[model samples]
Target chain A: MAANISEETLKVSYEQLSDLEKEFEENEVEIIRHQVALNKPLYEKREKILSELPGFWPLVLEQAPPDVDQYIQPSDSAVLLSSLKNLTVSHFEIDNGGKGDPRSIAIRLEFNENEYFEDAVLEKKLWHRRAKSGWTGLVSEPVPIRWKKPGKDLTQGLLDLVVKVWEEDKKRGPGAAPITKAKDYTPAQKELKKKIETVSMGGVSFFGWFGFRGFPISEEESRAATAKDRENRRLRAEGKAVPDDEDDEEDEDEDEDDDPYGLEIFPDGDELAIAISEDLWPSAIKYFTSAQETGDMSDIDFEDGMDEDDEDEEEEEEEAKGGKEPPAKKRKA
Target chain B: MAANISEETLKVSYEQLSDLEKEFEENEVEIIRHQVALNKPLYEKREKILSELPGFWPLVLEQAPPDVDQYIQPSDSAVLLSSLKNLTVSHFEIDNGGKGDPRSIAIRLEFNENEYFEDAVLEKKLWHRRAKSGWTGLVSEPVPIRWKKPGKDLTQGLLDLVVKVWEEDKKRGPGAAPITKAKDYTPAQKELKKKIETVSMGGVSFFGWFGFRGFPISEEESRAATAKDRENRRLRAEGKAVPDDEDDEEDEDEDEDDDPYGLEIFPDGDELAIAISEDLWPSAIKYFTSAQETGDMSDIDFEDGMDEDDEDEEEEEEEAKGGKEPPAKKRKA
Candidate 1:
């Protein structure tokens, strides 16, 4: 073992691995295509079966796997339990060739007549789009939940604020924009932000996730950033001058400091959606069945549990009582 | 949302969903087969590239993503850095058609001339087998490391005890035996257990993972259990008499109380192997490349950091400093 292992060797090896990784990614794309095709009938079958079982979706949410469950506030749970009629997850881009990502999904939640909202259906689309940093996952625009009354809003007004910001973002004409700075906010937006900050001191409601606009970078911007990153990495490997991402890092910190309502609502929204679509949706029947057998509907107190110091230990105890399992199922794309 | 949704409708819907889930699983299996084929040449290329770079595996281990890195002791790090020559992960069952699980992996570690062990290579094979609980994962019998001296043993003699116990298990005629009971332990076995308990107070070594025989249940037993569980669930759903698993749960607790050397060594061995094979192995180049540029060799202090109450906070700080990213990659199957 020598300390003199050349940087060139590592660079070459990394390049080779990157090429192999590309092949792996291509293989994944093919698998996603197949999965999209295969899931069509299963999803249809699921729809039929769920229709036969009233309160299926709501019950499933009550037993939501811990990751997604953490975001559900008491108010959100009440709304979902009372009104959520059907939940469907679909690969919306399946019909498109390679132009549209097959991993992109549409999550639709149908509601029966309820006091919470006027709309019968609330839908969110997540494009499996890449980020400037080369990481890729679900990206979406805010879908306003038409709350029937301010008192009935599960997000406690956070949803309205994010939706407003998103609508303002639409004026930028379909390109990636930097996260809105606090100083840049309109007076009304600032007032809404202040109100949301105070009201959502407990944390964002699960419904607020509908407003999640994953990494703000557009697809085109992401591609460019990815290319630039590659070039920089190559330079760094060669021990040549390479520009640092200090500016990007600073920007990220600034965005977090501002705590834009969308990001605040669900910083892990992309992953949450993935978990819901891939793990929770497919396994909803299991959760529903298990909850019914155990009579453990009272275990959905994630918001209260979040405030505890010994949350991990509390969760372990919950798991011991067969309350929930960590969402581990990842059936490909 | 009605409370009067019939149990029969729920049961029927569950059955349909289960059937749909099976289709999803079949699709997953197909994707895994394709991945296995696609990965073969890439792995071969990796082997070739690794040969050109000395100390690459050790360097990668130094930058091991947090989950795997947490198990590596300071002493283990010294041994690995000095002697670890090559690391290779392969799906051994790739050519076995449908008989063998394609997800089953063999992790091999080759050492150069070293003071720690006599063997040039240590290999552990994990069969992607199912447990009686219907959960499937990589399972293996212990692979003993031939340490040159007692002091050189990375597992602090825990491996030796497990190997003895495993040898004793071989005498039981190869059926699925319940976990070994403390009351049944031979005097020597009892003494060994005591010694291991005291010496391994710090926790199990990364090397200890080699002896991880997952779940301690045979594949035959698992299949039978799956069928029985299904039958029991149906019986329960029909409000008929169904045998409870309280006895099994008690047995599980009793087994844990005894702390069998194998289970004590690595309870999450199955998941660790999958993370290594699927996530770590593929991403080793990225880790190696980043580590070299950042010069962050000091960040691999997981074993020391484990004792602290602020371990999570410490990890966050480490991540902020570009120490390591949470292992998030899962290229499908």
Candidate 2:
């Protein structure tokens, strides 16, 4: 029955739906603004309560939703538990007088003095902005983490490589943006390939997320998106529709394949950031309380049915192989 | 450090946070109301466009999000694709003067003449009602399907059993509600165990969803929730805090185990309903267009790398063992 339907008819209807969707989106933004204002005092109270309870953030992070939790390796978990003092996610653009996106947020992770890193604080700010291609989303840049020793680098130098790549790419003349094709920088691509392999569990370190700068799209891909925007406007003006070019989409996918560094390292960075800011941050008390109920960080179990004691033993075994254990546990011993 | 903090302090802070969360929720309802009004015309337009495109809803269902898609077995898919003509989800209580819950919805599925059932339309209305426990969510009742033959029952008699159980339970005294423990009805529990084992793929049929009433909570469970509500109010009056009874919660979980029929059959029914109504229904055109791009129902692949031709072959093999294929494909062949 779909075979009998003309492409032009479907396109016209699809465009109409798209117009409706835009209206829905604009209305949703208004709701978000109201929520941001209403949640201010609640968030402030949450901050106070969390501070009163030590080791709260660590417990919350241990039971982080699966999306964000997957990025945190066992070594990363050890580091976070030992030093993570507090966590706060703020809608930084909330009070920007409608000039900024309300959804744009800053995630701050404060740490006590630790053996692993020299820095007392690490923060990643995501700005909700639109691209030249007419797509709007949260975009971020790499934040440097000052590891006391190379051996203590939780991201296994992946973050360093990303920083180096961005700096070098920026040095390239105009039009050579940070999120360009990896093939343009063959030397960095060779290094990235080696670094990615060293990462385990089909995911990068939680620390590596600090380097996320959003997904890359080539000039060709951007132009295609722009063309679609033009076509949609033209269809509205002409009061008719034509079949969309599927070939262009296929080519865009092929171009995406050329740049795998940022995508591979933090493919769902924006989503993960949103998840953390919107869900994990506000619900810290709930998550922390649940984690407390278990009497063990059972929610963090990636492997099948591993007990806390078993995990502790495994951590020791991992330490023998040059990994680190939570120093607080060692201090208790 | 948590060991040093008084339980009273934590409890007081948690209650304060809960109060704030309630405010956030009330604000959210306002947003949802605005969206419902703004979307009225858009949904009407969507209905018109969807009617023009044949097999559109089938294709959209074929590409449904994992949450909803998981419930649809291959046999169920064959039935839906063959007969499903139109699907609509409406916020039925939206226009009702503020007394009615705006979130209450009705999901309507229309079908063409088919050999499976006598009914041309199967509609399930889920009312957003508050339970005796003060918990509010979508509550529904079984909408019976008149199967033409015993062999043609897509739910394989689960719906029939559920209906019988509900009817029998309703006949009991006022205290013995529908969601009570399965132990109350020994004969039904025995039959349910038998029917449950026969259901494949750790899920029930798409047709079985017609019988989804919501998660079960016994009278004992309701009293516990009400008691907590009472305690919170008392605490507010007294301006003091007390630790919540973890023992009570443990007992609630134990009681839930005694009533496994509804929970086992549709553990996430409320969540699934929300996903369908909010995401799938509004995004039908997008899902359908993407399905058209593949030209095959690759999104519905349960087994690894199974092509359309392979699926058809498997269907034929299954049919030889007493099943049916989508008659449209059969006619084409």
Candidate 3:
């Protein structure tokens, strides 16, 4: 952003500027005065707006399903607060026109510290109605259901939009049952869109919010699904086909989309990893010893992934080797 | 903050309530549900308020004139963020209202790691319209001058609203010779009130903002005033006349009033102080040595208050005595 410097300037005497090393003299003062003239009242209005804020703004943001939007969670936002780049909590406040409907929040964000106020800040005063939810949200490109397919209910409309497209996907044989087989002929983007249409045909998608508290994906269930996705991804890459899972790869794909921008996760070798893990040996030994003494393994789950079978096998092996060897030593004793 | 428990009761089954051996399990769940019911709307509204807040609420509060009567500095406003409590720079935004009257801003604030959002945190909002210049201003209980002696203009109408009683303090005798004397007859509270009135009468009493930015009392100047107050108190108690300079005793009296709570200061003896000072000798020597080499003394201004007069005197005395005696004895060597 280039500064809008005015054509005319002012002068400063040497004595006046001496303390400040003749820096930003009266010329700056004049410029500032002109600038203030240009925009002083906004500063005044800013104070008024500040005073007008609802007291619960922070709480409103905090109460969002998983706290706030990624934009508000400075850690997750596209930009972080400067002054050495700290996180800026997304701040929001809802304006209810005397208990009226159509809820909307006035949102606030912090920009990169060096950015100008006009560029750095964002606020919307009007109360906005949030987008209606259906199967897989209508993102920003809100599909006009009536336009796409004339149906009474949004779900019916959306289904109408895609059901035929997907049912045809079932490529039925005459007098035989129908089945799904991904078409190679369709373009990748079209195929992908059709696939999404197929996945979202059944239930209402995006329950609580677009991404915050999803309807069908319970937190722990999501975790398990993620683990399955990771395993499936590994298996698929390895050419091990998992059957009947194609209809619901959407959850995994959506999960993958959550972390869209690939974080450059560099894997460090065991030189450092082993050194750190080895340093933990003394503590681990004491922990295992105590767990064995108390016969409690819940706290040691991560350290020892061994199940009862592994423990029993180890005991049997120890009996075969140590019991007989110790007997020979026992004769000497 | 008492919990509201309603008279109306609800019931549940034995199987449902049997978390314990016929204890309060059901009662707790019932009461909790009731409490949640009572408070859920408030919580919802709180979220709404949070969402409605001006983007720059915290910033505006940071700018308030400390008129809220809470003494929390930006650093000390209780709630500090924990990842750290490192002070982030304040952020602000101006609202122009498309260029309208009575401007405003939205401001934001940071909380300490553990503090909640409701703590007292506003300051610096006012572009304080300071009081115009005057000799002394009266606070509560403005005595009516007209009731005693009438002035052509108020001094009467001021007394009408209990405001202008202060504007007419200047009573000049026609052929008066200048005279000054501290009145001994007046009651102490009256005297104290008069003194306060005198201090506030000049150039916008609260130039900074109401209670936030007091006028003319630079932080250091206030400190000086407090010191002078302590000195004056000691002198007055001793019955020592400090000479008549009453008209401009803003330095001393104003200082005394600042610390209204009257902290019971008990001065510690110098013995412990000397012990602490003596222990620092080694570090001081090392510091000075390093400072001399690195030219780091520019950063330190506190330790070098002593002047050449004292050092020269010390050297001369040492030379006249120790040097002469040492030289006479050194002739043998």
lDDT-superior candidate, 1 or 2: 1
Provide i-RMS per model in Å: 6.7, 17.2, 38.2
**Residue A171 lDDT in candidate 2:** 77
Tens-digit per-residue lDDT, A71-91, candidate 1: 777777777888788888877
Off by over 4 Å in 2: A1-8, A132-136, A168-203, A215-265, A296-333, B1-28, B97-99, B129-137, B169-203, B215-268, B296-333
Positional deviation of residue B149's Cα in model 2 after best superposition, in angstroms: 3.0
Give the range of the ten consecutive residues with the poorest summed lDDT in model 3 chain B.
Answer: B324-333
Write out the backbone clash pairs for model 2: none
The candidate that wins on lDDT is 1
Model 1 C-alpha lDDT versus the unseen true structure = 0.68
Residues A165-284 of candidate 2 have per-residue lDDT tens digits of 767666775465444465554587568656777674456778888988764444355456546665676677487766676654654565644543333456556667866876677566
Top model number, DockQ: 1
Mark the regions of model 1 whose C-alpha exceeds 4 Å error after superposition.
A1-5, A16-20, A95-99, A131-135, A169-200, A215-266, A289-327, A330-333, B1-6, B15-20, B95-99, B131-136, B171-200, B215-265, B289-327, B330-333
The positional error of residue B273 in candidate 2, measured at the CA in angstroms, is 1.9
Model 1, total clashes: 0
Chain B alone vs. reference chain B, TM-score for every model? 0.76, 0.74, 0.17
Ranking by lDDT: 1, 2, 3
User: Tens-digit lDDT track for model 2 on B92-148?
Assistant: 777654534567788899998888999999998887653343555566777889999
Better of 1 and 3 by DockQ: 1
Better of 1 and 2 by DockQ: 1
Off by over 4 Å in 3: A1-78, A83-98, A101-106, A112-119, A122-333, B1-333
Question: After TM-score superposition, what is the CA distance of residue A62 in candidate 2 from its true location, in Å?
Answer: 1.1
